[model samples]
Target: MSTLTKQDTFQSLLDSASSSFAPIRTQAKETYLTQGLPALKEEEYKFTSIAKKLESKIQEFKSALPFAVSKEDIESVLFEGFDGDVLVFSNGKYLPELSTSPEGITVSSLSQAENTPLGSIAKPEKDAFSALNLASFSDGLFISVPKKQKVEKPILLISFNQANSGQVIQPRVWIEAGDFSEVTFIDHSISQTEDPYFVNKVVEIKGGLNSHVNYYRLQNESKNAIEVSNIHTDIFQDSRFTSVNLSLSGDMVRNNLTLNLLGSNSEGNMYGVYLLNGKTHVDNHTNVDHTIPHAESNELYKGILADQSRGVFNGKIFVRQDAQKTNAFQQNNNILLSEDAIVNTKPQLEIWADDVKCSHGCTVGQLDEEALFYLKARGIDKNTATGLLLYAFAGEVLEKIEEESFRSYAISLIQERLGSKF
Candidate 1:
């Protein structure tokens, strides 16, 4: 028998499972084996060495160290007095005792939900990480909203992970909104341990015709946390889909967000704010596709980097040939506070339609020296003046948040982060 190397251990995770979705996983396993992990030189992943980071965590994953999360652990990270359904997932398993589902919506595990849109929106074969997740993920969420129903309260998903040794955790979530339905979600992640973690998560959503959906994801993890997350959403005819991604802290975090406007008169919106300090790295990659006529999309992402941190933003908007009369726009702006801080930004637009209007651009610079002098002339201290300026800059995205409570909460978080930086 041959000795099993670390690579073999990583591949072993793709083993077929005994379940109804066995065939899907089996095919994904084959795809993962053939494609393997991505190389650093790959265009899509050129800036982030996610494959290397995953490999570094595989040894701890193979060790299978005993790990568990307590309710007190959940309490430490809970949003104070959040008024809504909150579901808790520790490691890779959902903890019902620490969760509460809303009254009207259908909430259940992925395996237990009927007529699930599990693999419909996510393409495992097209992406290596998706293939890896589809093959090995043990638990996930399946949330279904009935047709024409409007949820009164939002859903808050809390993914918390902790352990003594380095660990890896994957969480999957699927959401389906029926025609004319309206719902909102807050997907927040937290890591409360000093040990490093490779948190891999995939979230897929399907919006029915004329439905309304809003998704806000926040990542605030420990300094040793490494995360790779993909969120894919599809909006149908006359529907509206909006999302905001907020990253406060992490060692290495990569977020891939994809929005597909599949029907006429559909609208999609993307907004984000990433605040980095220390040696943290956060990459935000977004793709928006207009597949039909009369579609519109808008994207804005801003970042404030201090210390020796790094930030990356790559956004691509596509207007297909059939997507006539499409209006698409994207902009990414960054403010570097320190000489050692770095940012790589690229905003791209590909339009095949003759009657479409699309544009993309980016900006990177330090704080305005004249503005600082203007503030100091009024007796404002340097640090306070800097914090106020950054808050105003990042607040552009935060102002787009519609939910009153969440908007307030997000504003507070951003203000606190900016205040501590200076």
Candidate 2:
């Protein structure tokens, strides 16, 4: 056995990747060869050295079938009181036997779908991770909602990684909402192993005229696992798009969310919360682009870091020259619970339109000592008082979740992380 260099690891992956993607994959490999993995020197990845992390886990990138997962494991993660349609993927392979076929929507494997919605809103050339997913993925999940159809029940996508030690999984998803269609989607990722592994996934969403799409993503990976997820969405005329990301725990996690308002009067809302502890690391990068006049976008992200954990946030809002009357706002806030905890936050706005209202800001600080003292004096113990204050600090974002059950689940996860009774 010998230590592998970064080039060797990447070459190995390219050598084993499928040629089914054709010229796209060919171009991606070429780009990767030139750009390689994102390094610390790259401005976009300055705070997080993903190349180093990927190199460390390079040996885990093996070709193996999905590891066995019991029904009990599925039951444990399901949302209570919800009987909606479900799609389960084990090690990035769709398991039909464990999924339910729901109506009002067309579902198909990407190989069988009439359209492969890639390189459109989610540009592979713009990012190496997206390019890697396009080049390496075997099959993908595709869902299409018909015009004027209201998906009464929420659609659930469970991406569970069950692989042996030192293995990797890549899952891809594409969702399309037809004109006037309405749907709610939940995307979740979990792992069953305590051993080191990696999961890389990409999600693309297209919203047609006047459509409404609500998307929520929850990442609760094993302590030894690493995950990189890129989600890109396009909003059309008069449509509405809202998405929230909750990153609970992982050895290393990176999330990239981009929303493009392509038509006038479209609306976009982006929110996220990351509660990290131990030696975990989480980074979130969000981009909201307004290309049309009269469009609007709002973004807010918060993080709670304890122990020696680290968090990073970079949000950018871009208003094109023709995007007059556009309204865009971005804000990021963080609380460092321990002296060792660290957070790097940057909120940026690039506005070429003079009439646009664009503002961006970020704040990094510790908990409110006066608030904690007040709570403690009100007959609450120090631990409980601290937990309550933290809960209140996160409530602003948690309250945005519309689903009661999901909201409760998110709150409970926060409480568990806080070590508070209640």
Query: What is the TM-score of each predicted model, taking all chains together?
Result: 0.94, 0.96
The TM-score measured for candidate 1 stands at: 0.94
Q: How many backbone clashes does candidate 1 have?
A: 0
What tens digits encode model 1's per-residue C-alpha lDDT throughout 132-168? 7887777678888999999988888887777544456
Please give the lDDT score for candidate 1: 0.82
**Which prediction has the highest lDDT against the true structure?**
2
Please list the C-alpha lDDT of all candidates, in the order they appear.
0.82, 0.83
Candidate 2 local Cα displacement, residue 152, angstroms: 1.2
Error of 2 at 356 (Å): 1.5
Global lDDT for candidate 2?
A: 0.83
Candidate 2, residue 288: lDDT: 92
Backbone clash numbers for all candidates listed: 0, 0
| Candidate 2 residue runs with Cα over 4 Å from true position | 1-7
